[model samples]
Target: MNWLKSGFELSFRIRPVGIALAALYAITCWATWRLSVDQFFLPAGIRVAALLLCPPRLWPYLILGEYAYFAQMRYPMIEAYGLGWVILASACLMPAVALIIHLHRKAMEATTEGWLLSVAASAALVASALKLGLSHLLWPAPPSMPFYSNAALFVLGDYIAILTVAPLALLWMRRRSGYDWSVWRLPPTLAALCSLCVLGALIALVGAHDPMARALLQLLLVLPVIALTCMHGWRGAAVGVPLMNLMLSVTMPTTGLPSSFDQTTFFTQQIIAITSTALLALGSRITHHYHQQARPAMEVSQAIAFSRSAHLANERDLRERALGLRRIADDIEAALGETAHLLRANGHEGPATDLLRTFSSRSQQFRELTSRVYPTELEHAGLYVALQAGGLREAWDSSHRLVRPLLAGDPCQLSMGLQLAAYRLLAEAVLLLLEEEKGQILIRARCGRSGGQLGIVFTVALLDRHSTLTPATQGLAIERLSARANAYSGAVQCRTNRIRIMMRDTPLDSAWLAPPRDVSYSSETSARH
Candidate 1:
């Protein structure tokens, strides 16, 4: 018994289509009974309601339900328009409506201007016309039905039904399937506008007012629909469309709704809302693209302004540094002058004069030291000489066991900032090695010119019992060295205990060889002399 139960459950789970068909047939029976027999609630009279509540694949089942109900209630007593006629009529009209919707779907995918509007208008008109023709041929007309006497009014009513209902139905189904309800949450302003529009439409409907006012109100609904499209996009418009239709139904006359006239009006309002929603959503999207493109230009302008300010600040700092160096040079010259005078007056000629001379000599040395230490020469000398003078020699000797020149050739020209950073890195590595207890390190540097670029490698070896180093202390020195490599649009990498930094050099004009000197000499030097 348990095995049979398990098999039954598995069979039901596997036959999803069967389960759907069964459910649809059951609903159709209920709908037909309600419509032709009881005249209480019927899918035929409220086709939009049926569509919204039921699935598209189940539409034919509802039609079948209509046939069964007609046979049971009205067929024998009133007429003998067989089930075949009803089926034939539904087949001709239903396919046209479905095809129109399908074409509209294709149009929406086109991503061009006016495509959505074309889709909405064309689909709605075709659907309405098809339903009007079918209803005129198949169903009996009554005095209560709107435009029952005129073929044009019937088409218009049908057109309105398809246009108003279809798009909204499509949108609602999509949203429900995705389980998103954000469309329903309207902003206060939009909600207020929608409310006012509803009120105006209500007044127009109630007062049996001027035909022009009613027509104008009908057109005005399009404005709010477009506004909704702009504010909330297609999905929002879809939700709003159905809501507007429901509002229209409440205001308009209703005879408990399975009446042919009531169903036609309901369908028309639904179609209008949906079609306008699509039109507005598309317009909103186009407007959004225009705004998106403009945003980047504004950001770029702000960025340019920020960069300009930074450049000015840097120039200012360089000027201040130049001034400070001049002041320091002047002070040293004055101190040397007083010492020279004191030595000459005391008559301690040989020793005191030597001391005075040394003092004066050091002042001159200070001037020269200052110039070389902060020279623009490295930009010309490039990375090679910069490293030598900047104290990397000791590290190179210990790490690579490099007793002789580690890098030698025609100048390895590189960017000024890169040259400075590389020089600093090598110097730091040597210092770190020297601090070690057993402190013997091997360093090596190699330069290669390849593919219009220069590559340099520097490595250091340290002897420690524990080979592993902490992350904070380990390779941090090399990591800093690597950043220098990056400034030249190159890379820095390290493996095991070896750190390698490589950069490519750019071809330069002869003018770069002789960078012009911009140094200003101290005028105060003459006074000290």
Candidate 2:
């Protein structure tokens, strides 16, 4: 028994492929059953044979099981009755059932419960009617017999059996194997199983105690089972549907069986089967709707998680960079003081004193700029003033042709970190153009309301030849700009020859602008020429 269980477990572990194959086997068994008990049992033997021999080509065997079942039962019966008439009838019925199942399977994949229910229900109704019509026309025997009461009875019995037995068997084989549908089939197997169970249970409940009460109960059961399948997966439905059906069957009345050829009783069964099928489809549709909605919510949650992780990583990198800047500032400040003292003590005359004075002043300025870029000082004052203090805009206005604040509105309300980022981006852009010997660089900074959000646009355009700027220059500026923008929940991008930076509206903390500690650094040996 343990070995048998282990083997079964292995078979089910193949996921959707296993589930799909099991469903195919179930279909073949049912088709075989249509012929005779032996025909039904034969497919089971064939399944095992394929399992041992050519597992990869198991689908052909499954299809062949259907063919074999029909050839043995329906075809032979037709031949024994009258070759022309029987063959024609079997040809019509067998193909029709096969086609119905195929179409139903496709519909089930696309729609969920609705299409499944529709296909199953319609098949039950149509097949039941056809069976009764065929029996009366060709193989009719005694009236008042339970099996021959009417077309409705035939429809009811077949519908009940397929809806109940097929779903249970399929769900069992699929769930016991513990498989996910992702590996093989397109549609979710759990979803299909849920739909089946819900319909089965519904029929079992509603039809309880009635002559075809079992069929009604199964139909009713499928409604909720489909819903449960959507939530808990097909496994729940697989277990639930069959359990409910068995319960209903055990509880169902066995008082007076209807005669097989009684048209009224048969027709009544058909009505119940058809109605149940329709209801199941409706329930399945509702389940599918919920599934569709769930996917987007899941995607949104994943995207948010990714964004948060990225932000945290960026913050870590920036924090490390800030620490480095702090050390550089301290060194530069010490260097500036030393340079000033050297000039004074050496009794340096005009030219030497002047040069030392200039170097000392610039060194102090560079220290200030570094602090603004790396610390919360810029974060406090916001981007506009940070640039002004950093000498980014002042430097541009002094050395270049255009440095202008395009639109002045309420000072942007944003975090100090964002302001620092914006300041650095502008500084980088201006510096790149200077390297190209570009005479005119238009730097425009604006803050205002747009799209119900605070909008900030910083643009730099070269007045000189567009080709003057190298790719390396543009790329560096963009990298710096983008780094800053992303930190603030904004983005920076370059289009054509212009860089565009935008920031969304956010509340600003007024205290952020308060003066903060400055990092002084040594830069005498490293000073640029």
Candidate 3:
């Protein structure tokens, strides 16, 4: 069963499991025969599906299974036609059909959207056409078997059979494990099956012989299929189509089916084939959309991974280096301070004062060197304090550029990762403004809990006092700010010279530590400056 299982490519070869394969094919032939009605030839579908799913080697086993089935169930009919008639039909029918499908086998197995549907249609055509010709080879057909209608009926039946069965076959073969099924009530599959049972019983007993009533019942059958398609995508159609076919088959007696071909039944078969194909295609599109939407989460992870992992570890290393540098600087400063006191004690006041000034400046320079690596002040003082009291504010203020600070909420709510991101965002915004050299940059930041998530909103408004800071310049700066904002899954909005950004942390106390999203900046890498 596993070797002959769905998705196992069948090749032409002699295998030890010939008997078991023969048995499997025989069972398949028998089941398809039982399910088929006039113009709904399921056996043709099975033959084609087996060809497509299995390898060429196992095809001989299928042929043997077909012969066994014909001998076991169809021998009586062949006996009436005599040995010569039997031999001709048996040799020509399935073997010819198999050979034809094998020839176009590569085309049907293509990666196109048609997939099994194409196989079903092609196989049904070849099988039905071959069977029709073989049916007339030995003798004239019965009076009841009119040629044109019978030919049309034969092809439609096989085509319908494939549409109904092949999807279910493909679904089983590619079924994924750990699928999240609804835990409440009955599972959708069992529920759908039970619904079909009840529907079949109602249609059979309702005595709706009129066209209007029958039409209503048929419409009822289609609604469930649409509903299932919506609920589970193409997978839903795979399950629902087979069930509808079963119901339509069960209630077929009311309309006198399995009797002969007529206008109503022929049209009904065509409609079923067309609609089922449409639904399966639509379902595939829906499945693709859902997968596309989930990819952003993966994008978000990749974007922030380097920042959180390497950058943060690098920050720690810088801090340690800073401490070592500061210790060395402090020792020299202490030595200078001691030496300055001795000189002043020895009546050299001017020399002692200059040395004291040199040591003080050298210590501050060491702090500046360390800050370049990891913003050491930002670590100890947090974001608002770093912006308000640190060298960032002092440097610009000394250059006659004003940075007006407006900060709110508890800074402690943000994790170290987010706090660092906020500092970078603010620092970069100020740097852009400072480049203009003539604008008042109003820096505004607020940290607060929004529902479950703690978040920060940072806005920098450029109060331009010159014609040089044009609209284009503000747009370019906004673009840079947005790149950083977007990488953290934040929302960015700009109006005039003001750009506002909102980024959230995970709910509860820990910051939203999900990795940075790389996709956000994919389109705006030029703005990273």
State each model's CA lDDT, in order.
Answer: 0.47, 0.49, 0.64
Best of the candidates, TM-score? 3
Residue-wise C-alpha lDDT for candidate 3, range 1-529, written one tens digit per residue: 7766665665765676877988897898777665555655566667766765677777778888877876765465554445654555555556766776667657544333345665666666766565556555544443245667656766777777777777776775555634465631446656665766676677667624554454456557777787787877777787788777766665554223222333554566577778888888777777667667766976776665543555456556766887787788778777888898899999999999888787678666656655644566776877777777665665657756665678998777677766776777777767776775355777778998877777899887776623245576567666776655654557666666666778776431133233001111111110000
Q: What CA RMSD would candidate 3 show? A: 13.9
Tens-digit lDDT string for candidate 1 (1-529):
9877776543323246545554564465445333321111123223433344355666555444444433443334334334543455434533444454455555544433244344444544554455445444554542233443333433344333433455554554455444345545657536746664675566456424454454345545555655665665554455455455444544443333233233333344445545654565575465457457756975754554343344334434553574477578787667756766777688756876787678667765564444334433455666666556533443354455433445644445444443544555565665554543233445556666777676555665444434433344345755655544443445555554444556554332112322001121121110000
* Clashing residue pair totals per candidate (backbone < 3 A): 20, 61, 17
**lDDT rank order:** 3, 2, 1
Ranked candidates (TM-score, high to low): 3, 2, 1
Q: After superposing candidate 2, which stretches have Cα over 4 Å from the reference?
A: 1-60, 67-94, 104-106, 109-111, 129-148, 165-239, 250-279, 289-529
Backbone clash total for model 1 is 20
Best by lDDT: 3
The positional error of residue 460 in candidate 3, measured at the CA in angstroms, is 2.2
Q: Which stretches of candidate 1 lie over 4 Å from their true place?
A: 1-84, 102-105, 108-150, 172-190, 193-226, 260-529
Q: Write the per-residue lDDT of candidate 2 for residues 19-45, one digit (tens) a residue.
A: 566566557655434332100122222
